[model samples]
Target: MKVGLYFGSFNPIHVGHLVIANHMAEYSDLDQVWFVVTPHNPFKKKNSLLDDYQRLEMVYRATKDYTKLKPSDIEFKLPQPNYTINTLAYLQDKYANFEFALIMGEDNLKSFHKWKNYDVILENHHVYVYPRISGNHIETQFDNHTKIHHIDAPVMELSSTFIRKAIKAGKNVKPMLPEFVWEYLDEMNFYK
Candidate 1:
């Protein structure tokens, strides 16, 4: 099976994420898109993130109805400061039958070189990059081995940090996340 691994913290899985994953699965050769919920990203600030389990649960709840979309806790069991290269290696070893590709926004591609063993990652895996406001200039820097495809997924200005700020300010996030996920967030008093 060809799977596109969409990795993120997903503090609260939003519609924009769902749309992009669905778009990748429907438009590309991928059979499924797995939301690999990262426990902790090496490049991001740890203080700004929620618990890994909580983020995974929100992703699970938000994508429950979609069989094509799955929430994976693969990174939860892996070592801290999750890196894409390591995760790819682990997944390849664990699921030998599955062919995986990296799914990410073009914005991330701009700083791709900063990642650990990025050259190996580019050589081994396919990357499906969606259009973003930034990172267009970095497209020409990719080598022949790095398969980068541009997608037309809708752009959403929302981010997990914005959602957290809204919740902390007692603002409504109903428009930002799915109904069930918002209920879970409210019930647990998360982001309070």
Candidate 2:
């Protein structure tokens, strides 16, 4: 099985995220897409994040009905300031039968060089790069790399940070969130 790992904090899973994952699972060569829920991302501030378990729960709620999509808490036990390379290496070793690839947007590719051991990832695994507005340099930089595939999946402006802000401001983010997620957020008064 070829699994694509879509890593994120998912402050809260939004429609945009679901759409991208769905597109990759259905249209791309990936057999399944796993949303690797990170406990802490080195690139993001910890103060703005919800509890790791809460974030993981939200991801579970958002993907409960999706058969090809899964929510993973793999980074929870590994270490602080979770690094993608470490998680990828661990998963690769544990699941030797299944092939793993990285799923990211073009925006991430622009900063891919900054990631720990990014060259190793590009060299060993295939990458599915979805289009994102304002993301450049991919065609110029990765054009020669066969593993880096550029896809035209639907782009969404929604983000977990934006959703959290809306919720804190008492805005209705129901349309941007899954039904179960909206229910959970309303009941728990999260991010308020």
Candidate 3:
């Protein structure tokens, strides 16, 4: 199976994330899109995030109905502060028959070169880049790279930070989240 790994913190899975994942699964050649719930992102502050299992639960609740979208806790089982290169290597070894690709926003592409063993990742897997509103400059080398594909997906500006803040301030951000995820967050009193 051709799978696109959509790695994120998914502190509270929201509609914006669903839209992009659905778009990739339906519009692209990818057969499925797996939302890899990262336990901790090296770039993000750990304290700001919810419990790893809590975030994973939100992801599972959000993606339960989508047959093409799956929630993966693969990173949770792996080491903390994991890099994309290591995850890619691990996935490649475990699922030799499955072709794995990356699903990322345009903003991340700007710093792609800085990733550890990025060259090896580019050579091994295809990167499916979705549009982001961020006006960051991308490297000229990846502009026309064969391994990098710029998908004409919608620009999702909504972020988990915004949702968390909104909920904390006693705002009804239910519309921003999936029905089940909203219920789960509300019941758990997360971010409030």
Runs off by more than 4 Å, candidate 1? 41-48, 134-140, 143-146
Better of 1 and 3 by TM-score: 3
TM-score of 2: 0.92
| Per-candidate local distance difference test | 0.85, 0.87, 0.90
Best by TM-score: 3
Clashes of each: 0, 0, 0
Residue range 1-192, candidate 1, lDDT tens digits: 999999887977887888899999998989999999877655676765778788898999998988899999998888776678889999999999998999988788778888899888877888888876553445546634437777777767778888888999999988889888999999999889
Better of 2 and 3 by TM-score: 3
Clashes of 1: 0
Backbone clashes in model 3, listed as residue pairs: none
Candidate 2 C-alpha error for residue 112, in Å: 1.1
Ranking by TM-score: 3, 2, 1
Candidate 3 contains a number of clashing pairs equal to 0
Better of 1 and 2 by lDDT: 2
Error of 3 at 16 (Å): 0.6
Residue 158 Cα positional deviation in candidate 1, in Å, after optimal superposition: 1.1
Find the candidate with the highest lDDT and give its number: 3
Query: Tens digit of lDDT per residue, candidate 3, span 7-60?
Result: 998988899999999999999999999999988655676666898889999999
